[model samples]
Target: MADIDVLRDVAPGVMPAYRALVASGELYSDAAQGMAAEKLQSLWVKLRGYDPQPKAAGQNGWVGKLLRRKQVDEAGEHPNGLYLVGEVGRGKSMLMDLFFAAADVPRKRRIHFHEFMQETHKRFHKIKADPAVSDPIPPLADMIAAEAALLCFDEFQVHDIVDAMILGRLFEALFERAVVVVATSNTLPDDLFKGKPGRDAFLPFIALIKKHLDVLVLEAARDYRRERVQGLRAWYVPANRYADAALEEVFGELTAGVPAGPESLYVSGRKVVVPLAANGVAWFDFSALCGVALGPGDYLALATHFSALLIDGIPRLSPDNFDEARRFVTLVDALYEHRVKLYASAAALPDELYKSGEGAAIFERTASRLVEMQSEEYMRLPHLT
Candidate 1:
């Protein structure tokens, strides 16, 4: 793809670069995705150190209309930003990645939303530690705004109350500093943090998002992620090389040619590494997840980020390793709640996995979920981000 910095001053913009990919058969044209690209093209041109000025008196019609946002903004001014919303596999992240890389802005950052919030928390913690630091948010926001004038976020969703509360004030300050934001999410602006505990306290953040960012829904005619997951066996028993091969196929199909690599997920400022991850699918050994001392937060973060999980070698549960057994159950609960596609190679069938143990009863419920996940109904369900 031609750099948007060149596309910025030149005639050919982001849309033409997208078309070149289509012509080369690397991508297929979708009107919905095209519209999103156009919107991004508008941003790509204007964000290259372009200083927008306050409109003079009587500056009306198309240019004036473009200067001030309607519906999403009541403050009469909004920074350059967009919030892309759609179901999975609409190419939201792909387009955002292109724009982020190609945007001419020198000070820019692209990050997963959770990681951004985690980093923010870390910064806040350090600032709060200083006795003289009466308020941390203002200076913190200034530093962030200066560092990344343009911020691109992948998979923007809030699952924690701590993040929820901090976002309102933090973003308000970021917007005040003219830090542009572009984010992608599976949920709508209204539905973010919906029905979560302490959701009422998070409403202000929702309002601020709607106020500052234009929400664009990328509607695509082609979404094969459901079909892709359906083709794979959700649970494979008698862990063997054949089962491993099946999982390899599943990972390939899910990621759609994205290169696999080790992924470190941050939970409460700690890193939980996945052996291999690409797109929204993560691959891990059962021991890596269960044998390790990971809590509900780690499990929840894993469930939230990945749409599909491939776990290798889930051994039979016993009283000897009840802690791992319990963690396995917790992991299953988180995955089921988020409707993540679970593919695993196990030593035995769910019911037979735990023969006799104090944690056997708990395994039964997870077993039932494993069975249900393989059903046609479950295969059709959308992964909740």
Candidate 2:
């Protein structure tokens, strides 16, 4: 690793030098250097249960595809990059990291989706606000272009309308500037905005993605989280001096104290609040929640603020409840993707959440996802800790 860092700094700007170093195999390679690379490496290590081995030529698999793409790109045709999609715990991010580390791109930038969006949003707003700014988009686009010939994004899911609207323009700018994009996502490009109302508005963005990139699915059936969940019977709770302090800390972290007073908590511009009953139990009206309007951006905000979550009053959601069920599913999906620890006291386990009629199938699917969320392996340790 030390040798690779030195090599990265000292090597002349040529492909043969990198190829020679990689062939010599003296430096210990790692995917942790960049965000995308780290994500890919983590997934690779998890899936293989060990560090990756060198590949043989003509090997045709995920590794092969990536290597082949790297070779083609090295030869200087078009930007040969990959977009990896898969189920949770399938190691899409890990694979991406390996590719980034092994591939010899002159410049590269790997970013987490939320972090990248926040930065882009911040930059865009700053540029718009500056009176001296002229042609902000081109310079900003060129800046990103200059910094990275290859760009990798992790957890690339789209639920926010604003993000959806801008993605087209952003990608358009990126493509025009000839930046190669590689992303790891749980959803397909077409299905990205699934279930978002009026998502047809973003079809052009979807089209642009299809036009610019090749998409691959990693279909290996293993659910790594399932093993982790079964291994750890209970969620981790911090030791506290007092139970009340612990409770307050946990609840505060989860809710961000969105004024649990008389007014309802605003989600996506909707007025929905967590209510405390006579018994002092907290419950939220899932049906009235607006993740789309408030945007999935808040999910990152909430994640940044909280380390642990205890969702109570879920049992109150009736069997026939569709809207609440959908909301719960979305929440679970987002939380799971963020690797958040979840604890809930429900009237029934996920299996019993929907035992009744017509909505049973969808409820069952949601139930399966919920169970996956509880898997001990799936839970990620808090970043702060």
lDDT of each: 0.80, 0.53
Give a tens-digit lDDT track for model 2, residues 1-385. 2134434544332222233334555322322222333333333332222112222344433222332332234332344345777776554654564455554556777776765776776777778788887656755665677677678887787767877777778777766555667887778998988889769888898887877667777764454333323343322222223423444444443332223433333333445344431111233233333223333544444443233344544543445565566566666656666565665545567787677766677667767867776664455432221
Q: Least accurate stretch of 10 residues (summed lDDT) in model 1?
A: 62-71
Error of 1 at 101 (Å): 3.1
Please estimate how well model 2 matches the true structure, expressed as its whole-model Cα lDDT: 0.53
Candidate 1 lDDT, tens digit per residue, 126-237? 9989998899997787678768768999989887889888899999878765677999988899999999999988898899888778899999766657655565687887
Report the alpha-carbon TM-score of model 1 versus the true structure. 0.80
Colliding pairs, model 1: none
